[model samples]
Target: MTGLRPAPARVVLRGRTVVPGVVTGEVLVSPETISGWGGIDPATGTITEARHPLAGVCFTGRILVFPGAKGSSGWSGFFQTTRLLGTAPIGMVFAVTTTKVALGAVVTRVPALADLDDDPVAVLRTGDRIRLDATAGVVELLARTEEEP
Candidate 1:
């Protein structure tokens, strides 16, 4: 799973879903370290003062793959505000689970897949196009080429 290969079949993972948007950009993978409050901007979907290495980057309509939630409980609210502001990820992929992220998922109602055995952050590149099926609990990687619109 580390090396490049043809697009694989949709992988399944059972977890909560968050946000409602179309995953149309390259996959941004982050394993284990994600701060809810600062990781994203509700008004812009851009990564705010999250302190993460990828801070200030935007995730609007992209598939945000991570291990789990981090930082304050206010994380959920941030995502809620982003949804209200029309700036939210199309879906989410988590390697682990947490109460805070779960609540956010329930509120956003976006496609989500969690508890993934394979590290999406490690396997998915920043520009890999992806499709998430929350209802079926599957994530399909399309080829990696140019950045998505």
Candidate 2:
């Protein structure tokens, strides 16, 4: 069917460093504003935001791409819980890093990236293979094509 075509043949992104590390993994994208406080279940890594596009989605072991984190100073606490629960994202790519999200990234102890040459959140899609180099502030992405299953 015409609607089933794949996209993102191949692409690379650059961004500012947050946590400073390198990692490669599948990505989970959040098209809606994410709140670290009530948005995710730390133990399961599931997005709990009712109206969020990625609701009920688990980002564990993936590169999480989101515009930014919103609401409550408790953001970092929840993310830290993710780390302790072993359900944390391997890496994070944020469009804008606010204090709360920044702290979350730091406490989550995962490689984090932001302020890219182009917004990684928009350029990347869910299920894409990504290599996040937070130390070097770069992301190497392989966009999927319709040819691949």
Candidate 3:
């Protein structure tokens, strides 16, 4: 009922929603390798590590799709800062559930889907538009039809 269409590469992830909202945005997939401390910049919303492939990139207004949270427990605090900075992502999809990410999502108050059975990393690509229905616990993909002016 949420107008979700079968994506070209379909995958399903099921989890609890820590935050509540309807969100749709580009997918930024990171496998189970995102380090909490260096993966994101709370102040600027830019990924700041040179070693990371996604360095210097911004997650503002995007759907951050990741397998799980890794490294520091300080992860939640960063999201809190980003929220204060007003540069947080629209939503998040996690293949596995973690308390760290859960707390972050709760604090940030952003729509988050987790505990997915399928690997969103494998099926979802960066820049792919994602439609997340938090109310129904469903995620759908719609083709990115270029930037709208």
Candidate 4:
């Protein structure tokens, strides 16, 4: 048998930068909106809202891909706590840009991108390995999950 293996599928997406930085991590997608104020436990980095699709999921270190933030302006504060607690997302790619999310991304101090040429929430799936270059406004797909095929 041949020793060579096929290269992983790759895709590059362009978007507007929210918080400029670079990061590489696995994607954790939330198809629905996330409310940081009453929706997540910053200490654990887990979505605590019962009805949320990503509820009970811990986003620490993952690149959070979601529609956008919901609820009150306090959302940013809660997200900042995650960063302080050392459990913040390594990056963020969202379809929508709200004050809450924009502020949260800034305070979280992670690579963040928004208004992608493609719908990030639809194109990016959980377990996808990506290099988020927010400064360059690029999201490079590095690998896909084994379960995807």
Q: What is the TM-score of each candidate against the true structure?
A: 0.78, 0.89, 0.82, 0.92
Off by over 4 Å in 1: 1-25, 145-149
Candidate 1: residue 108 Cα off by (Å): 1.9
Please rank every candidate by lDDT, starting with the best: 4, 2, 3, 1
lDDT of 3 by residue, 8-98 (tens): 4554445565566788777777654565676788888877767776788788888888777777898888888888999988898887678
lDDT of 1: 0.68
Candidate of highest lDDT: 4
Q: Encode model 4's per-residue lDDT on 45-142: one tens digit a residue.
A: 99999998778999998999999999988999999999999999999999989899999999999999999999988887788788899999999987
Go through the candidates in order and give each one's C-alpha lDDT.
Answer: 0.68, 0.83, 0.73, 0.88
Candidate 4's TM-score:
0.92
* True-structure lDDT of candidate 4: 0.88
Location of the lowest summed lDDT over 10 successive residues in candidate 3? 1-10
RMSD of each: 4.9, 3.7, 5.2, 3.9
Clashing pairs in 4: none
